[model samples]
Target: MNAKTETPAIPEGACITAKVPERGTALLGDVVVNPYKLAPLTAIIRDGGQAISAAHVRVLGRGERGVDIAYEVSERSLWTYGGIPVFGLYPDHVNQVEVTYKLDGERIRERYQVYAPAVRLPVVANQTAALPLVEPIKVAPGFEHRLYLFNHLLGEIPGGRAFKWNALGGAAEWDQVGNNWIADSNGDVRWYLDIEQIHDSGRRDGLGGTMGFQQTRDGKLIWGQGQTYSKYDLLGRRVWQRALPDKFADFSHEIRETPNGTYLLRVGTSDYRRPDNKRVRSIRDHIIEVNEAGDVLDFWDLNQILDPYRGELLETLGKAAIQLPEGVQKQESTAANELLEGDLPFGDTPGVGTGRNWAHVNAIDYDASDDSIIISARHQGVVKIGRNKEVKWILASPQGWPERLKAKVLTPVNAKGEALAEEGGLYAEGFDWSWTQHTAWLTGKGTLSVFDNGWGRNFSPTKLAGNYSRAVEYRIDEAKGTVEQLWEYGKERGDEWYSPVTSVVEYRADRDTQFIYSASVGFLTPEKLTTTVLNEVKYGTQDVQVELKVSSRQPGSVGYRALVIDLARAFS
Candidate 1:
């Protein structure tokens, strides 16, 4: 027999008296504050009868520097039976929220004064005093209304004795240190994900927090931490969660959604055996394509695709390439008869070392136009591979590469279309290949944009005082096998803008600008500190329209990546 349809029950403790000002609309039944109890500065409005077609919420700012945060509830199902999720409420203040929703093709607007109690922000271990989370160093006029999501590590440095390799018995819990947060133009934290809801407590490995926090085109946030990958709507609602397949051990670096609805995840191989029958574990050198159902469709093992032993740059710079913050003690040789491991002074999560990190692939971007994958390997260079795992092109200095692989490296050319000498072409005038780079992706114009970390610049052993990182774009002529520099930033600022560890460069076609994130700017003078600077630069002129710096009192606080939240996407 067919089961009878049951009426959906109203949410528990929902305010039934909440109604539209004049319409007396009882269709919008209950209003519950923080329905999930996870996102503190949020609320939920249940639909009694009429389904809400759309919703827009705006939280008023307090002062001139405080920029108002607002977004439209993009997910329709969020307002169907569970409740309409409200976001961007100010903590410890009577936040003035302007809510507008459509019911039965009629628009209904209401004003809500939500007083969200202040919450205690997480403190890193060894910190004895309270410190400001993010500071607005510079706010440009036209870019006053923007939000940036910073993916960072908040606890004490990993790879230490207390939080070493598989030790989870550290003094600070993963939940206590927030690894992901969103801040407005005024440097006020508008929203943050309580890592407690996503961190895997049972895991013994130190890698438990989010790594790559990014918003999808549909206005949902997605990230990969350890072995789990999760996607959640802006309302702090988990849409779906998937785990890595058995072959993959841990997820790191990046997770990107393909146009075909599959996900490209950067993961570590469980136990890989070399051609010489040497069994060993590798990290951050594998990429797998998994569907929404958690099925591994295709895999790109960097060990197989690239020469794993190519370490000319790695050996020259050693641990200095990663620029580990000051005060972190370097590890000595262990008594146990184990393989010699390089020092990852800041933490192992940064994924820099000699063994098992040959091709530290920190970023991945797919090109549907030709079914190709572009990756940024810190030890190696920016590489593009085809569906069959064949190297399409290598964009790096032609040094120490095998004769066969060196043939695939692109030749550098000057602006006047003259080919520079291959021996020192990389450091030639107006052209230089990135060293220890981070995020490499194809821009809308089909050109490649990379966050050139500039570590080991020109393969130099000493850290030059003039060393600088830059957001560089290159126009590659595939048929000609040559590359030309298109535009760059941060090089003019010199060492002050050099971020050796993690950063990103994204092209914003909508605004004709580039979003450059300098994730780790270490200052060791008066005190050891790390600052993250974000800039939105104009396309051709290289004018910095927005410059915001995130300062942390905790030394060695490194930011992994930062992305601009496209608020307009929520309404679209």
Candidate 2:
């Protein structure tokens, strides 16, 4: 499908009339379902995917602020270019009205009366912000510990200098204590593990950042790289890193862990080669398989699975169209004269997988049960991948990752598929990030929490410059790869602890006490009122207590002292 941007005249509450490619799909096909108001209407197709880009998304409006879309049909897990949620629209099912450019722009339409007959609000809707901290609530308990590392700078030079963001140390698993190890992902390689004082950088010089993990027991751990799954002993010694490279082309995207002690990594580049420079750009999004010793075993690619042909309904391939899913146009044979030594075929440059697809990733997760893998793409929202690098299902985000949630359904539900109100804040348009993902976390109860940073500029309503960030926790209905809404982290409903465009995870389970916990947005240090200002409730509950880490550091100051907040008032 043609992926480019051109302003289309959008009229409110009128028959949708938008730009159309000479041939292919439009942003909105026709009669679409509008879930919020519960009606349907004719909507317009705004900015869609594109032919080429350096970072998957090139901010459209100003600098680095436009909508980023993957025109590939099968991979239509649409989000704001920044991994945030944008509204979704399809033909004959739902009508979508969007206002992505301004802070107040909202393309409000009625709900589809005929579509989704069974979908209804759990209780009457109300606009308010009040969420009570429920039972089993507490920041992650901790001891005197810190593991992992960080990259101080964004490395973008030759030979790739090792860097760190903020590597922390502690028990790796929050659901279990026996599995105590510190781990970190320096926004690069995820290899900083601290297992009972086992430090085996091997002088390889590794960096650290967001997350970390390390096994507690003694044995060779299996973590996959490209083609080869590497093995590492308890002492951080490289036992062996090996994998059959048949599908290990570019496994540098990301990684996750299996409860069985295995590792799940990514392969394939998310960028595309430029026809002008013959240089592949932004080719860095993919999923791979890895083991403890850091060996690459198997791999999968969203490019081969999401059929772009389906998007042809919106528009035909442009002169610079990248490869679409399932529609590989057989290339014509070219003479050696047609080849260039400076082409991407050389070692220094990146590959152009079929010379088509763009840079967009699916779901990313690590399973502790049966060591399975779950990946969703901006194009293909859901995929169940296994250690053998096999795809089991193509699923959708839970409850369609509902951008909008009713206050009543926000309550707890029974196993028979009922809804309850848990909090009150927003009816979100999920994963509408303009640039890329901010955070993706998996809970022990099969919950996938996503921090969708709203940043897209193309799809309308992106220009609004407000604190428009939120966090969402998804309870996966594995039978359909559908993510159901359990909770959201935002200010409207009081779910957010911090308004961080960038945050980290500190998850753990207390083995001795049988407790699961977390503490982020700065360590448990006092003097930094960041945590309390963002998350700690100043209210009172019979069970839950409110606490804060007090510091004399003025609100707008530069540097300040760090100390831990003491136990104070209860809120629950």
Candidate 3:
């Protein structure tokens, strides 16, 4: 929260005039690099329970002796990872910095503690239970190993269906060549997954999207959205069917498979009537263990696990409000400004017995490495559940990260280089009025990154290289649970399409590439892509779909091209 500062250090020939996260400064460059890939980084750090990556850090300036160490930790690309975007480095009081990492055959155990670098930090500590199995399926023999990502609760999508939530129930199988990704869009995470083949254009109630496994069987179609149809062969033919008992609840979530090829899904009612609170979708979120034949073998639910922390931190965080002393009052008001602590990324789960029957699941992704299932809570933020039903990570957003009323007036950068937030404006969302959009993740060499779709204001005179829509990146410090801003691109990046009112966000880590593929769906669609970053490159390829193509070429038709400038070669 830069208040009384201005004249930020920027590379020469960079954007001379523009906004930060909102109105992006455009740049000129040939396609030497896609420009949209990821920016290089010199540092990385991770902190807290949730894994975050940051780019820069203050090495304890030799000044204020043992004073508080405040650094600029940018997190423009945070929400893409199902987290929040809190750019800048603030006061994270710590006396020492200690880090320890262990590398075993194929495992890595790294502990990071900022208070004391000599000791390690505790990322996660929880109890786990054992689960028994029943059925067994067939797997091709001679397979060395396997990886899977599973979601326990097949939930629903939030934000009215435009985007998926991060906390979803699904599973994915990963290997060297490729991995089969299955998730339950049932909520936010895609649940249905099968690496071997592609199922029908999987969808529930015949919706365009569904949660099911992806397998290739000659072209047959089978979706696990409702778990009704039997398995299909390559020829679009059902090879096996299930004989469901009439009175059975007839459904479930968390479909985990055994090494022997057997699988099960968790089942439950919308909300179970509890003695303390009765209206919590007892049927909504439950853990049902079933055999591959759609038969129930075992079951569990949140009601069973119930707040393991026993309402200690949850309650403390709930009522924990930081009191700003009178002398340091940013906004002097008689009402003693207090700060509320909890900030869940997705949405906040009603404390204990709120009796609120609403839970929105956004997206789900399977992690084969540790066999953990990652889910996004649009209201809560992030929740990672291990195979044993242990919530390894319950990372809520930092209340300080958002609503910086006092932090705003101090935000630097004013109009005409005024160096004031008000004059220059606080955040210019390249486009205005956009509530929020999609996001993607990126991890490579030295930076853990995210693509922030600043969907607020669409137009700004300060765009640099391309057209005009903003996408920001952050250097993630997973070990320290931190993030730093790396770069911002939008119309200045030679893009014709300004930030869309609403669109999809996805990241392809395979090609070490991330993309922000949006559309002009909502409020205003600023003539999609006039010119992409390609046309500017001497060897650029126009065949690529970056530029907008309009045949009539009318007065307001789309026909934009990116302007490339090879800075490296320019000086030579």
Evaluated with TM-score, which candidate comes out highest? 1
Write one digit per residue (lDDT tens) for candidate 3, span 1-572: 11112221232122222112222221111111101111110112323234443312222211221211223223432222222111111123232221111112221212222221111111111211110010112112111011111211111221133112332211110000111121110101111122213222122221112222322222222333332324542212244545322222223212334333444333235334544333333322444444556666544354333231122112222232222233543322212221211221111232322222122123333344465544332223334456676554433322222232212112222223332222232333221211122222233334322222333222232222243444444343334333344444443543344533222223234222233332221113343212111110111111221222111111121111111111111111
Q: What is the TM-score of each candidate against the true structure?
A: 0.83, 0.38, 0.33
| Rank list by lDDT | 1, 2, 3
Question: Which TM-score value belongs to model 2?
Answer: 0.38
RMSD of 3: 26.2
Candidate 2, residue 492: the lDDT equals 52
How close to the true structure is residue 260 of candidate 2, measured as C-alpha lDDT? 58
lDDT score for candidate 1 against the true structure: 0.69
Model 2 residue 20 lDDT?
A: 22
Better of 2 and 3 by TM-score: 2
Report the number of the highest-lDDT candidate.
1
**How close to the true structure is residue 545 of candidate 2, measured as C-alpha lDDT?**
23
